[model samples]
Target: MRLLFHVQHFLGVGHHRRAEALTRALVAAGHTVTVASGGAPVPGEDWGGARVVHLPPARVEAADFRTLRHLDGTPVDDTWREDRKQKLLALFGDVAPDILLLEGFPFARRQLQFELLPLLEAAKAQPRPPLVATSLRDIIVFNKPPKRHEEVLDLVNRFIDLVLIHGDPALVPLERSFATADRIPAAKKAYTGFVAPVPPSTPNRIASVVVSVGGGAVGKALLWTALHSRPFTRFADQPWLLVGGAMMSEAAIAALRDAAPEGMSVERFRPDFRAVLAGADLSISMAGYNTALDILQTGVRSVLIPFAEGGETEQALRAQLFAEAGRAVTVDQAGLTPDLLGASVNRAADLPPVTLDLALDGARRTVEILTAREAAR
Candidate 1:
């Protein structure tokens, strides 16, 4: 089966990374996959045997996530939207895929409706319309208004054939964030568990503390706090590896590095971040979906300071859930300080590794689900 997957990540690379994992899994399962990415490319992403289509990229200008701009910082105007829509339609016509998978839409990434609506229209107009599914992570941002939920429900019911909730329902259900999830037919809804990398063997475990920010776009506060808090912790003399995500500016990275006291080191990104986490004494970072998955798979003691800007509650909720389960410690963004962060680090470091019962075979399960759906069709 030929599959066309669309993903757009504005703030961080987590969304694209998960999509890439699913793409690779689908390809491994003997399906030809084409990924259409609308966000700016990360430095060293591996799509793995799947065809890639780079749409005119755009990124969030601020924590508000309201304004989107090109890599050059120019605002995305109507002309750019039109071009992207045309390109997407052209790609859809060319691929004529057996399955059309949208990473997040109606549920999230409503900003791309300009192109996605048109793409959906084109897909439906096909004589034998391909199965259209929305791929989503466990928790969604819960700040959307009631009207927004209604809009999403209407769109899903009208166009989407399936909603693959890529998370363990036992851990966190779709309705927690999406209030109207029950409105979607049960036949169209399926859980594929949480998509995460299989834990690699820890052959060369680095003993330093690991701190990371997903994509490095909005992690300056957390990174800076962690750097300063390192000196205040019991492991003051131990090495602290601070990863400033790929999107972090070099100037910001240099500033953080200069601010670091004796035992701390800083870098832009780490390709083997999960391995680094697996070997570390403790993990410290924002509680994004991918980062949380890495922490869970490694079962590393962790201190999570979820990014709460722009009224985003997804990460905060995830951190709270993990904390309640004793998997990690949480430091609310509002009360984050060097002393508090240091205390949390010490507390998390002293805890034993947590063994979670949630499913980690989501990528493979996703492929199986899509393949079965295709076969039935």
Candidate 2:
């Protein structure tokens, strides 16, 4: 089967990592995959075997999203949405994949992806490809009542064949995020277990606790608290590693590097986060979908600080849900303090780790949904 995947999120790497995991799963299950992204491409390497196409980058904060802006505060708009969709259709015409998987924003991107109309039309015209699916994580962060929810719903109603939600319903409720479950006409929604990518190596020895604020775009409060807290060295033997994401300015990185604590190590970024995560005894990080799943997958105890920005508190809610279930600890962004973070980190280290296998079979599950739809056709 041939599959096409799409995802966009600029504040962090959650979208890219999740899409890459899905693409890897599909290709590993013997399907061809291509990723068309509306976000700036990461500098290195192809994801699994999936071919990637870069479109205009999109950024999200809380629940609202828009085209990336220039330093001059101008919103970047290139008539590229249509151009990319046209190129996507041409690529679809070439391989005519068995399925097309849209990652976030098909029923949620608002008016940004107006070009999806043609792509939807092309998929409808195809005789062999019987399924068009949309994949999403457990939670979605939206601030207001969806402004154009019904319009996007119409497109999904008309074209989508399946919805693959990557989360356990027993834990995080999808209804809190996406309220359209009962409205879709011709699609099926399945709650796949949390999809997490496994890191290559499991470290033999554990030393310091690792704290990360994913991509370091937001949630500096968490980092600041974790860094400034004096009790962090209570474990005196256990040190700390802080990862500042690519979005951090050189001056900021230099300042952070300069302000390093006795046992604290600071860096701009690390490509293989799984390894970093796997080696850690404890994690202090923001509660993004991919990062949360990675921490859970590695069975590392964590003190999660969810962003308090405008979005409907998806991460905050997720942390609450997980912490309530004994999965991990939760710290709110507004309430975070050096004392609070340090104490939580120390206590979290003593908590038992829940070792969930990080390998997600999203591709095979996706193939089953797609091929089954085709066979029924």
Candidate 3:
């Protein structure tokens, strides 16, 4: 089966990375996969054998997430949107895939309706329209107005054939974030569990505390607080590794590196982040989907400061859920100070690692689900 996967990540790389993981899984399962990325390319990322299609990349200009800009930091205009829409349509016509997977639309990425709405219409117009599915993470942003939910439900019912909720229903249900989840037909919904890389066998546990931001786009506050709070923590003298995400500017990384005290070190990114988590005494990071999965896989004692800028509640909700499960400690961004963060770090260090029993085989399960759907078709 040929699959065309569309993903757009404006603030962080987590969404695109998860989509790429699934694309690789599909390719491994004997399906030809093409990934259409609508965001700026993540540096040093390899998509293996999957064909990559680069759309006119755009990113959020600020925490508000209302303004978008091209990779060159220029504001996106009407002409650019039209061009991107046409290119996306052309790609759809060229691929003619067996399955059309939208990473997030209707439910989220409402900003891209200029292109996605037409893309959905074009796919349905096909004589035998490919199975259209919406691939979403565990939680969604719930701050939208009631009418937004209605619009999403209407779109899902009209165009989408399946809704792949990438999480365990037993752990966190879609309805927890999306109020209109029940409106979508049961036959169209499937919880495929969380997607994450398998843990490495031998982890390099060189650091006592591991701090990271998802893409480092909006992580300055967290990183600054963590850096300043180290002296107040119990493990003040221990090695603290701070990872500035790929999206972080070189100037920011250099500044952080210069500010590092005796035992603290800073770097741009770490490919073996999960492995480092496995060997660390405590994990400190924002509560994004992929990072949450990594922390769960390692079962490391953790302190999660969910990124809640721009009225985004998904990460905060995820942090709350994990905290309620006794899997990690949560500190609200509003209350995050050096002293508070340092104290939380000490408290988290005392807690034992709790092994979560949720499914981590989403990549394989996704292929199985798609293959079965294709066979039935």
Candidate 4:
């Protein structure tokens, strides 16, 4: 099957990463995949064997997530939106994919409705329309008005053939977050276990503490707090690594480097992040979807401060589930203090290996679902 997948990540790269995992699985299963990305390009993302198409990039600089700009930092207008929409429609015609997989469409990415809604219309108008589906994470940021849910329901019931929920329902079901999820017909919904990459497990482990901020755009508070809390923990004397993403300002990175409390290293990126987490004695970070999945795969002792600003509730819900399962220690992002973070670190360090009874083959399961749907269609 030829699969054309579209994904856009405004703040964190978790959404893109999840799409990457799914496309990789599709490629490995002998299906061709073309990933159309509209978010600002990630420097060294691995997409297995799938081809990539980067649209006119747009990103959110503020936590509000309302203002969007291009990679050149110019504000996006109707012209850019039309250009991107045309590009996506052209790609659809070129690929003529059997499966039109959108990472977040009517369910989220409401800002891009101008582009996606048109693309959806184009796909349906094709000679033989592709199997339209939306690939979503376990949770989403949905504190909007009632009409938001109504719009999603209308689109999904009208166009989408499948709604793949990439999560284990036993941990956090869709209804727990999406109020209108129950209204989606059962045949249109499927839950693939959490999509995660398999990191290399080594013969030995590193004793250092690993702290990472996904995308590093909204993590200055957490990063600085980690530095201040270092001296209060048992691992204070041990080496620590602080990884900020490309989105972090150079000034902030430089300041973090300048203010290092002695045994901590600061950098912009780490290609082997999963491997680093697997070796770390302890890890501290925000509870973004991909980061949380890495902790789950590595079973690293972790203190998760879910990013809760700008009406984002996905990470908070994930942190809560991890706390309930004893997987990690969760902290309040708004009331984050050095002492508070230190205490959670101490508690997480003493817990047993973070074990999960949930299935981690969401990537594979997603591929199966897509192929089955395409065959049946």
Using lDDT as the measure, the top candidate is 3
Query: Which model is ahead, 3 or 4, in terms of lDDT?
Result: 3
The TM-scores of all predictions, comma-separated, are 0.96, 0.85, 0.98, 0.95
Model 2 per-residue lDDT tens digits across residues 1-377: 67777666566667677777677766777778777776665544348867777665556553444544533345655564555667667776766677777776564555456666677788898765447888878887654456566765776678887777788766665677767655665347776667665544655323367777776767555666777874654555566777777666677778777877677778777766667777777788888887787776667778888886644477888888768767788877776778877788777777765654333654456556666765676
Compare candidates 3 and 4 on TM-score and give the better one: 3
lDDT of 3 at 370: 81
Segments of candidate 4 deviating more than 4 angstroms: none
lDDT of candidate 3 at residue 183, scale 0 to 100: 83
Best by TM-score: 3
Model 3 stretches with alpha carbons more than 4 Å out: none
Q: Give a tens-digit lDDT track for model 1, residues 268-334.
A: 8776778888888888899999999988888788999998888789999899989988999999989
Worst 10-residue stretch by lDDT in candidate 2?
Answer: 62-71
lDDT values for all models: 0.87, 0.68, 0.89, 0.86
Clashing pairs in 4: none
Cα lDDT tens digits, model 3, 183-262, are 88999998888888877777788899999998888788789899999989988989999999999999999999999898
lDDT of 4 by residue, 158-265 (tens): 789999998899888899889879999999999999997776656134447888999887898899999999888888899898998877889999999999977788
Please state every model's RMSD to the true fold in angstroms: 1.4, 3.3, 1.1, 1.7
* Per-candidate clash tally: 0, 1, 0, 0
Better of 1 and 4 by TM-score: 1
